[model samples]
Target: MSKIVKKTKHKKKGIKIFSSALVVLDSKSLVFFDHKTFFELKFPKNTVNDLEIVGLENLNEALHKFIKENKITSNNIIMVLNSNLFFEKILKDSGDIYKEISNFIELTPFEEVCSRTIQLDGETRILSTNKKLVTTIKDILEKEGLDIQLVIPYLALDKHSLNTENILEVNGKKDLDQLLKQLLPYNLLTENTVLNGKPAEKPKKEPKRQLFLQERENNPKSKRPLVLLSIFIALIFVLIGLVLFMNRKPPEEFTAPEIHQSMPLIAPIGSDQQEQTSGKTVENTTIKVVYDNNLDSAVLLTKGLSSLGFNSVILEKAGSESNTSKTYIDFSTNYPQSLRDKLIGETNKIFVDTVVQDSEVSDYDVVITL
Candidate 1:
């Protein structure tokens, strides 16, 4: 368990930095430390629903007013869902995050390469070690009605006492048990531990119970065989891929017995009467023209946004959160879901419920409805 969460040791100087729950309302303050510092922020004075937060509204009013009053430099935040939110298959054909495991979970311009791809607040067990802390933070957030900007793990530390370089491996109950005893306060293991559904917990640690990593490893063995693990993982990938592949309107198709009926057979044909594939995609040089209703100057600024990579663009109408951010830009052709983030970033506008269905552009992508 420690091995999984341990910091990747480096030869460079190690910095002992203090951490705190950070909330960023404005961008200017923490622009320099985006990666190093965990952050949850919003533009000040932006109304989210019926509430408004002053970008300068000190969450820790007076008690620690020095942070803002004196312009101090400190805060540790970590509230990134992309870090550990869903099952992911590091794509072999594409590295773009907009290409994810599901159509249900929308992708955004922001992507973080933290410990896990996602960590659902509840009912998530794959990364069981972080569950308790995750749930604890989730409760606090919901109860306080305070949308968190970040929540660094309380057990997280780079101290030499817990040698980050050590390696421990075990398959049997005895070996696994010994391994659990080593990780002290950080270890979330139960004293009445269970292996193969039987009880086994050593009486130690302040808390009587903790999440035994070895026990979690055992849970899989009881449910299914090891050979099926590969098949299960593969099945999950296909399931997600199928969802993303839906609603994609390629130019042509044909029946092939060898091709699985479950998979859509779209043979992409360009304007040159050439057949291409998902593998041979290259960056486009064509201009995109957007006409969003949200912004007054959307048409004038549309050309610039297109140059940034939108194949063809036009606007539709916008929607709401939990609802969909919409944008229907009539291009000369079709497009894909991949356009969501680029469109959002380029125009500084969001499409909660949008789609681009253009017939004029012959070699465009797909008609996105995301």
Candidate 2:
């Protein structure tokens, strides 16, 4: 028995060195990411309702097809499942959490359930989900020689504190937003949630009609002053407009400058010298500067870049700690190398030896991190 156990341990050790993948399972899709690099892989998408036999069949078929096409062979697998399927309950007593979870599962309507328990403070949190789905994933992967290491509900992901770069690889913004809402509720949504990584304007919550009317009624005097001020402002604006119109100069009489083409233009020393002497044309480009709670440094850096003739903006300030304080710069793959070199040379003091990489930033030429 000891010899057999030794052999098993040796086999487990051998599996760790190979490239592993994380399989993220959601209601509508299954995404595969090369775990170490977070490089995403092609995977199948199937809208599933595990409770239904037909849904499960389609999901199984999709998984089978993915395995066959990819020729996946190994036992290193990490699974992140959608939280919507999980059922969480709080138990008052600090009794055996596992036992409580099993009892809750037995009473629940779900025919197939798996449970996980956590003891926090004096209370027990029990989370249960569809066991059939988990089993299906395991069986499918196992058949393809993939071994499951961990299975976690997406909401409980914060407990593990997995790499955030993995989250960045997920394909869709809608899916990313749903994942963020489930995984990290306290963290404010940022531009990173979108595929392009450009800041997306969040829809402003409209004021409740009844509340607005009630507040207006309560402050009737406030409304009159605002109304009068609006009228006064409008009159002032009209007077200013009339005065500007009167001061406006008539179209300047066209007196064309004498043609200077007849004079031979003196050539510069060399083409390169001429190009170097040409005036710099500033672009109307916006650069996104994302920082980790260090808004003062970010603000100062933004000012510095703005002074250097680059259109810069402080894109985001992450409320939480990032994995690294080392800054990063991401720009277009085709960005001019000379400008890039100059940018790094000038900002090297502030950003240090930050590595630059390629990324998609909507309406922005580059993105910076600090």
Candidate 3:
């Protein structure tokens, strides 16, 4: 039977929260489609953070992990302009013939644009072309072996800061805004959301924002009540302590215990191993895992072995069957994610212990994924 000790006390270190990342960037190779001032670019009531970048090639992997941890896949992102590499050239000659012309021009190689953003997919429309150099950027893409599917014609245009209502005279932007209205969805920006229309009255926030406001409304009162309660609790505790001290019966703890002593030999920790604190107990253990595929799985399994207080964990892939008529296991950790994902690709095969296999992969310890 365990008794709750009232007087006996132990000190503990307060827990520290591990900070989470909201944004992870590859580099400054970005272009901002910002219509608002930089001051308005951020949220007034939310927190924003970024991560360190290594290189462009590893950008996808970094973004994958970042999105996984934040539990968010899509959000408004700000991309920086790489001034050293990117250029903004407003072509005037290819206005009406943009789609036909840009298809040939983007293939023209600009060494500066080579390391910059690649065209994902886009439509071309002439922004009043006068006359300029035209070339397709296909050679650069071919040199990189990138299969281009999206031919998004990005205008190498100069940044203009002007609102439609403010401008009294039209400055050659007649059909562009109409075309822009059609293309707003592709930009992921709000439709009819530009400076042309009467400024929206900042639409009433959804219920989501109301929750925050409600929390704020309750916070001050809650804190005040909490403080008052704490003071009351402290007063009661002090009273009890004072009473106990005044009429104390005294503690009977003069002698040390005469329990038998024993010699213990602790095995030295392995070089690749570390001590594990599980829940509230210390344990000596050994773990074993077998994974037939994935270099990362092998690495993670080895790491889990030591992290779990295990003596050792061994992993071995299933080899070609020793006997005839053995079914082949198309095991992989590539794009498919799991066997089910690769199931349509690999049919007529019996799955042995599918849940058990997937559970170990699905129930991993990390907050993010590869």
User: Highest lDDT among the candidates is held by which one?
Assistant: 2
Clashes of each: 42, 2, 20
Q: Write the per-residue lDDT of candidate 2 for residues 1-370, one digit (tens) a residue.
A: 1110111112222232344446666544565645233222223334255432345566567777777676655444556665555567877555443344345666645444455444444444655665656667667777667776556555445443544343433444564445554443211111111111222223234223221001223335657898999999999999999999999999979998898687889974553453254422235445788888778878888777777777645468766778885778886655555556656765676767588888765456677877
Give the per-residue lDDT digits (tens) of candidate 1, residues 42-130: 22233121121232224223213323443434322232222233223332224332223222122311121112222223211121223
Query: What lDDT does candidate 1 reach at residue 190?
Result: 23
Give the distance in Å from residue 197's predicted Cα in candidate 1 to where it truly belongs: 72
Off by over 4 Å in 3: 1-57, 68-87, 92-107, 110-370
Better of 1 and 3 by lDDT: 1
For model 1, where is the 10-residue window of minimal lDDT?
Answer: 108-117
